[model samples]
Target: MKGIQSTGPALLMLAILILAPAFAEPAPNTIKIVCTTSVLMDPATYIGGDRVEAITIADPTLCPHLQGDIIPSRIQLNMDFIPGADLFMAYNDSNDQRYNIPAVNDFMKANNYGSVTWKTVSDPSREWNTPAKAKLLAEEVRGWLVQYDPINESYYDERYGEYVKSFDAIEPTPAEKEKLNQTQVIVMLWQREPVEEWLGMNVVNIFAPEFALNGTRTAAKVVDDINANPEKYRNVSFIIENMQSGELAKGIEESLKDKGINVKRVVFTNFPRSIEGVDTMAEVLEHNKQIVL
Candidate 1:
């Protein structure tokens, strides 16, 4: 997966100069952005408005873990799009060990073109619990949104402040707070490494199929929790970092059903893309709220 380094700064400057007019006219304001997956691309699109030019690498339904064959068309697309990109976003973490990230990283390094940033959508602190990890990852995304769209800093700060206040308001009502806490979820991750931190250093709730497909005691506990009371826990969620097909999702659903528990809500959080949009952080937060709530 080795990649050649990008054209040096002089060539990059030359390329930028050549592309500057194209951008200055009407399209440059629309920053070209590339995402590793569609889950990330969609939300970015909502926030970017018309200013971003985005490209997604992994389709929503493909398994990123198994994406070994890099299409020539995609490579050519990246060559064409990345040179003109204002920002490049990628999910670089231990969990992506299965993907061809080295090649991707090499390409970005060689280009030295855009403001590249890495996002670990999964919580690295926690082991395998999906609910707590998803919440943490959501918070991380808020920060990324702020960084990506700094023009709306004040608005994003205010909206985030209000969101926190709303969460606090619910705390005063014990019954309501309990209800929020009872919103149990189960995340079926594509891998277990990246989310270790999000699950907390001490917490360990996942079981890899390679080691023991059925899961360990910690995972069993979560399964028990879901089985203990499914009615009370209406919102069960899972964040699949690695790309998975609809059939895999169905398999997870059926597995839960076998335990007399069914998943109520599901959200896809990762994807691939080419363009970058320019929207406020507030907008991104609002979109996340809609997906989760």
Candidate 2:
């Protein structure tokens, strides 16, 4: 009788403990932030830590300008959380102005929800893939968090310092740089900065979308240039493609391979979660390095 009595109470206590979480309320003062892209979400997540709930609307794998069927579906799925969001953030670039913002607005309006008053976190149309930009983004996110929740300023500042420390650890070592410097690469226009300038690789040529700068060579044009002037890319061993920009270097890779030049192609994503297990800006940088190195 005594064993049964003691065991019954213990079992009840264990059950109550397990079920407590299911009935628990969210932490007080938890601010919900709606970010248009993972570029903003990644930093917000790291800097905000447990204090903020950050969410992204767009598919990081696709460019902001290209509104495929996925964007609409995502907005619909996130509609539940959209209404009570404390803050809305975006790049506010031409792409966001045209597609992302409108998609969000149209959805909100149709549902009778007011227009989103977005906080701009990035320069218009600027890329956020590089390490330098990533650091700047962390600062931007920290600043925004502090401004929004001044009471948690110290907490955000501490988290920002920790994030920057983690970022600094991923900086390529001199030996890694030497290896990168020895390799010749062909890269997408958006990926050129990280590959050539940051990684210290010898960039043989760059290919871009047809709508890029008037003088910039499109992928097809790059292939033509490569064939016309083989010497320029004779040593090119790798083609770095941008995931958001589509496979702009496919023709270039195929052409090089057809000409008996073996070149490896690697795609890099600017946003977290676009690649498996790459959930943060530092991991994104590390992921890019691991694939190429």
Candidate 3:
């Protein structure tokens, strides 16, 4: 009888232990933030740490303007996080106002959810792919996190410093810069900032979508330019393409190949998850750098 009683209590305690995790609630004061994209979500997560739950609307690969049907579907999928989201974050760019914000607003209104705070973390017009811009972005995220949760200001500051250090760690060495300066590249307009400005590569030319510059700078046009003046781009060893912008360089590659000019084509992405195992902005920088190096 004594053994039975002792074992019964032990078994009951074991059951409780097993079930505890399933029933546990999130820590008190853990604010939930819903961001427009991974660019914003990544920093919010790093700075906020355990004090905030950050979720994003679009996959890192898809830009806000191209989200189309993805917007409503993502809102529905993240309904659990939406209801309790304390803040709605975005870059306040035209795309967010046109696509992400309107769709999110409609969902909340239709569902009769209460208003959530909205914050624009950075200027949307600035290119954020470069290390300098990424550091600025991390600082902005830390500022917002401290404002949102003053109790954890010290923790947020520490995380922000660590995030900045990651960018510093990946900066190109002087020797790498010297080599990059000598390597000539033809790149996509969207990727030129990092390839030309950040990496210090000599960009011979740039190509963009048909809509950009009224089709004057399309890939077809680049092919024509290469054909018309082969010597101008003769030294170009790499053709860098933006993953989001589609394969605009295929025609360029073929044209160059036919002219007996061979160049390596490398695709770069501005967002995380666009490349497997690249989950943060710093990783994105290093990933793109390794491609050219």
Candidate 4:
């Protein structure tokens, strides 16, 4: 009975000390992770886990090109959500070089924050048009994820490997393969970049219009080509990216309607609003299945 004296108060005090760190909030200088788009944010969260907080500036539905000029407002917003962001993740590429990169760079420079360019981080090479390129990009993304959390390097590697596997899983069904063989889809992209090349390689019977943007000359050329060989290209479809070709879709849709040539559905590459957890390219493609090649 000598050992059973009252240690309850002392134990309670010790317990309080042990749980004090948990109860105390994180410091103002804690590391914060910011991404350019919600799509980019998804993978960041998966990789960062609880170690870092993630934030996105662009609305998932709005095109990054059209994010508008509210720099002061954005700065305030960033300050509020990510007071201690250590790094920024951007997804701007050569296609977006004209607008996205400048805007993101300006913002970071003005705010004096560190940033990692997605294009630089991903380092897309000439193989972007091949399945090998897709695998490479996936691996690059995995590498970035692991860089932030070295402890979970193996986990990130496995996740990215799964992503690559899923992308390769997209084999055309018999009907799709038949369509692929018979139909010569001309992917009229709004932007002239590796995306068209990538699509052309994977979709096989696909071709890109001479011009990537929607203009009177390009539109007329497309119409002329179709008219010249209507019998051969009747089943042909057009795929447009929402980011750059939103206006093109309207123009082409109208132009085709006026000429009585009913083009197939106009698929948007990126959505009109911000959607959470759309990390992988496969996920982006699957999300827009209605416009799949």
Best by TM-score: 3
Clashes of each: 42, 0, 0, 5
List the candidate numbers ranked by TM-score, top first: 3, 2, 4, 1
Model 4 clash pairs?
Answer: 60-273, 60-274, 61-272, 61-273, 61-274
List candidate 3 stretches off by more than 4 Å.
Answer: 1-27
How does candidate 2 score on lDDT?
0.84
Residue 242 of model 1, lDDT score: 31
Ranking by lDDT: 3, 2, 4, 1
Q: What TM-score would each prediction reach against the true structure? A: 0.44, 0.87, 0.88, 0.64
Residue 200, candidate 4: alpha-carbon lDDT: 34
- What tens digits encode model 1's per-residue C-alpha lDDT throughout 177-210? 3443444444444344322332211112332232
RMSD of each: 15.0, 5.5, 5.1, 5.6
Would you give me the overall lDDT of model 3?
0.87
- Give the distance in Å from residue 228's predicted Cα in candidate 3 to where it truly belongs: 1.1
- Cα lDDT of model 2 by residue, 1-293, tens digit: 99999999999999999999988985568789988889889888888988889779888878876755678898888988888888888888777777777888898889888877888866765567777887887888788889899987999999999988877888889999989999999888888888887788998888888888785689888889889988778788799988888877788998998888889999977778887888988888888887789
Q: Model-by-model lDDT, in order?
A: 0.46, 0.84, 0.87, 0.52
Over 4 Å off, model 2 = 1-27
Error of 1 at 105 (Å): 2.6
Model 4 C-alpha lDDT per residue in residues 1-293, reported as the tens digit of each score: 44555677778889999999988975434337666665556555554445557777665655555556643356557765543565666655543465544655666667776554443445522323234555665566566666755766776666666656766765446665454454334444432233344333222122233443344446556556555655544444553444433444344445445566565645545431333554555555555442454
User: Tens digits of per-residue lDDT for model 3 on 1-293?
Assistant: 99999999999999999999988985568879999888888898887888888888886776667788888999889998898888788877777889888888888888899655678855779878999998888888788887878877889999899988999999999999999999999999989999988999999999988877898999989888988999998888999998876787998988888888879899889987677899999999999999999
